[model samples]
Target: MTQSAARPAGRRGQRLTYLVKRLEMAERARMEEVLRPLGVTLHQYTALSILEAREGLSSAQLARRHVVTPQAMHQLIATMERDRLIERRPDEGNRRILRAWLTEHGVQVLKECHRAVDDVEERMLSRLAPEEAVAFGSALERCLESLTVPPEGLARHGDRTA
Candidate 1:
């Protein structure tokens, strides 16, 4: 009998990719549950956090960072603007480009979200020791870089290939 035929099927937990996807889904669900009462989704909170770090990202730039299409990002930006969580202004160098930044209210909301997220993360890492948690984070970062970096190692941040 073949090696594959010798084993039973439906062993999703044994697959690395399946476990990764399952973890991602669980994290997203928990984040959304906590963020819902704050009138923000996980994507919106991510955008807000990004804006806080870099205050002048264009819609296209933000979309690229989020790995989403520009049209979808535009809709998200529109919703954020409607909620007065962020404001956009024409870029000084490029009149056609709109750069976004967090409003005062946005900052307040983001701070609250940070505390809530910190709680979630603390719970998630509760089983691990501090050193183990650090190692786990480093491992995850290495895994991400392995997938994102090009085979030739020529691509930088904005130059990632599909």
Candidate 2:
């Protein structure tokens, strides 16, 4: 049998997912190392970035954006709050709804983290030409779009409330 046919059908379907997951783990590890001095994990850094662009997001909203369970986000937010990186307050209109916003310190730390992470990203993409980088980004977006369901009753990226 040819090499292609010799491989199990299940393994073929797993190849892409496996590679993507491995890349994600490697990227997270690199980010974790770079962000260690800032006392932030990849998840916290992501939350800070999200809050920087759009403040006052409810935990549920943040959870959806991060593709994490609400329970997981709750723990993350609580830790960030304790670290004074973010503040959580009840919405003025809805007392039951808690909104999260970055503190000034959070913004400052996030800026520093951005610079560090940017260096990491640059190193990762150094081999790709500008056009190739753009193409790769577009391809990743296409893959994400294919896997994600359309957000309903939610603001898209740039439309997020500040």
TM-score of each: 0.85, 0.78
Per-residue lDDT of candidate 2, residues 82-130 (tens digit): 9999999999999999999999989889999999999888887898999
**Candidate 1: C-alpha RMSD after superposition:** 5.5
* Candidate 2 root-mean-square deviation in Å: 7.4
Give the per-residue lDDT of model 1 (tens digit) for 13-110.
Answer: 25566677877888888889899999998999999988998999999999988888999999999999999999999999999999999999999999
Score residue 108 of candidate 2 by CA lDDT.
89
List the global CA lDDT of all models: 0.87, 0.86
Extract clashing residue pairs from model 2.
Answer: none
State model 2's lDDT: 0.86
* Candidate achieving the largest TM-score: 1
